[model samples]
Target: MKTIKVSVVTPDGPVYESDVEMISTKAQSGELGILPGHIPMVAPLQIGSVRLKNGGNTEFVAVTGGLLEVRPDQVTILAQAAETAEHIDLERALKAKERAEHRLNEVKQSNVDFKRAELALKRAINRINVQKRDF
Candidate 1:
């Protein structure tokens, strides 16, 4: 079996680096699946989970919108924020989800940024889903 080198990075640092047989993630346009010898390209990512399959196991990384660069033998995700399933704090994600939901429900408030709250809710849900390996 062959593998591709995958690296998930953020402004803070790298979140994941490994050799994977397949990679699945959500892009702004749609979902993408990459293999070891995938065509080189670039796409904007959405707030979602990145699934890396290797050795009959799948690992998950939660990304908060960024850019994905794919090469024949390598794939790099430069994300604004990223966290692996093992590192995601479930309690914190739940709290963020709650806060975001609260903000969204208060749409009549002038101070509330609906779009930002919606994005936050998406990110929070993404983290929770990734941590649970829902996909």
Candidate 2:
């Protein structure tokens, strides 16, 4: 099987580094997928999960937002924040999702920043959803 190198970096440090048979993530325009020998390009990634596949195995990573650069041999992700499924705290993520929902609901009456609340909600949802990926 063919594989491509993948590295996901965040503010603190690199969160994931491995060789993947394929990868998929949400891009600003839409969903993006890369395979070995894919065309080189740069794209803006959105708050969502990055899915890496190696043969029958798969892994998921939650990303707040980032930039994706794909080369013929490797894919690099420079993210604002990232956590693999194993590292994510389900309880914390559920609490965050609730808080974001509450903030979104109070945007009008509480003078909450609508855009900020929306982004937070999306990020929280993405984190929670990443936990649902099946092995």
* The candidate that achieves the highest TM-score relative to the unseen native structure: 1
TM of each candidate vs. truth: 0.97, 0.95
- Counting only residues 3 or more apart in sequence or on different chains, how many pairs clash (N, Cα, C under 3 Å) in candidate 1? 0
Model 1, global lDDT: 0.94
Question: Candidate 1 versus the native: TM-score?
Answer: 0.97
User: Over 4 Å off in model 2, which ranges?
Assistant: none
Best-fitting candidate, scored by lDDT: 1
lDDT of 1 by residue, 73-135 (tens): 899999999999999999999999999999998989668999999999999999999998875
lDDT of each: 0.94, 0.91
Q: How close is candidate 2 to the true structure, as a TM-score?
A: 0.95
Error of 2 at 93 (Å): 0.8
Q: Residue 58 deviation, candidate 2, in Å?
A: 0.6
